[model samples]
Target: KVALQFEEDWKERVYDRRYVALAHGELPKSQGTVSSYLKDDSHYVTHSSQEDNGGKFAVTHYKKLKSGNGYSLVELQLETGRKNQIRVHLQDLGCPVVGDLKYGDGSDPIGRLGLHAYKLCFKHPVTGEDLKFTSDIPKAFSAVVEAI
Candidate 1:
């Protein structure tokens, strides 16, 4: 496995992150933002309920990429990286990532979590050079997305 390194100044740079997820259904809008307070109250799940109290702020912007057969492919950009932020926020929207049994309806169409980091960009800590990385979405994900 490849380990990702983060610098102390990472928060100062725009870390553009993107992921591909299979949602249970279509979202209310093609593109929108989800913001909430998230707390890790359980080892198996994250809580987004306001009553959880004094949780960390988290935000994610998502866009619907494709939809068919009771599922939709969504691209997400996270503004904060709180633990389980995406899963919790998406679940709050009532469309958790497919195969994410911890947060969603527990449907495993592809036999694994339908979440993948597709791209990441940020400034290099030492070189001060702009760096970017992109990864092709898994074939299983692409197949489902294109089938729509």
Candidate 2:
């Protein structure tokens, strides 16, 4: 039997500032890391902009990889995985993922969530060996990125 462990590498997301502007949300003027605290109450996970809040500590780092007309292709790394961590953090950044109805402005430019896990790495549970897996970006995602 194989016991898989989660070791986050990075995720590809499309951040669209247009949505934030349309929704009257504040947009982050800078990009680097987000160390916001989060709390999961089953129904929803909320975040406190403060660092010392009594919520579960979550950290996500992001950088702009490419720019589009009104959006950008971003690479994100999660230091601490939590429920809806990426989505929540993106929302906090005011550049929610395109096609993310729950977090963004209900846009579906790709007809699916604009989030993809392209790589995963883990250690073998029994042999303690390192293993890694990778996959190509979906055609739909690629097309959208290309068009944007």
Candidate 3:
């Protein structure tokens, strides 16, 4: 599907990729493309070999404001819409989004995907009005403001 739409190899254009779960559960560690991830700077599937990696998921153009353990901001258009596409994809590669249940540290007390539908800069679906709006980032994404 990606090749048909983008008309490109797509793989070479992959600046980063991963697999993440968007549902709640513990996944087997022996899954996903871990080898490629270790050698490729542009890939991160998840943390460690075992951890949950899902919950409201979204794929954004991830932008890390700092090195590992700092702040991160991923901005991405909705690719394959799914309850957990972002989380699932990230988990597939192996860096589930933070705070995710099916795809993050099980310690996450937060019950939502850190992802948000912020900054919708487009015309109104009706009324033909030009508009741009942004959804307030959930307080939970606090880890973001200081870095991005």
lDDT of each: 0.80, 0.59, 0.40
Error of 1 at 126 (Å): 1.1
| Deviating ranges (above 4 Å) for candidate 2 | 1-31
Q: How high is the lDDT of residue 130 in model 1? A: 85
lDDT, candidate 2, 1-148, per-residue tens: 2322222322212121111111112235435787777875566746555666668888877766555446656666677776677778878877777777766787667667777776656555556566676666566644554572
Q: Estimate each model's TM-score.
A: 0.87, 0.73, 0.43
Error of 1 at 59 (Å): 0.6
State model 1's lDDT: 0.80
RMSD of each: 3.2, 7.2, 12.4
With candidate 3 superimposed using the best TM-score fit, by how many Å does residue 60's alpha carbon deviate from the native?
Answer: 6.0
Model 3: number of clashes?
35
**Model 2, clash count?**
0
Q: Give me the overall lDDT of model 2.
A: 0.59
Deviation in angstroms for 60 in model 2? 0.8
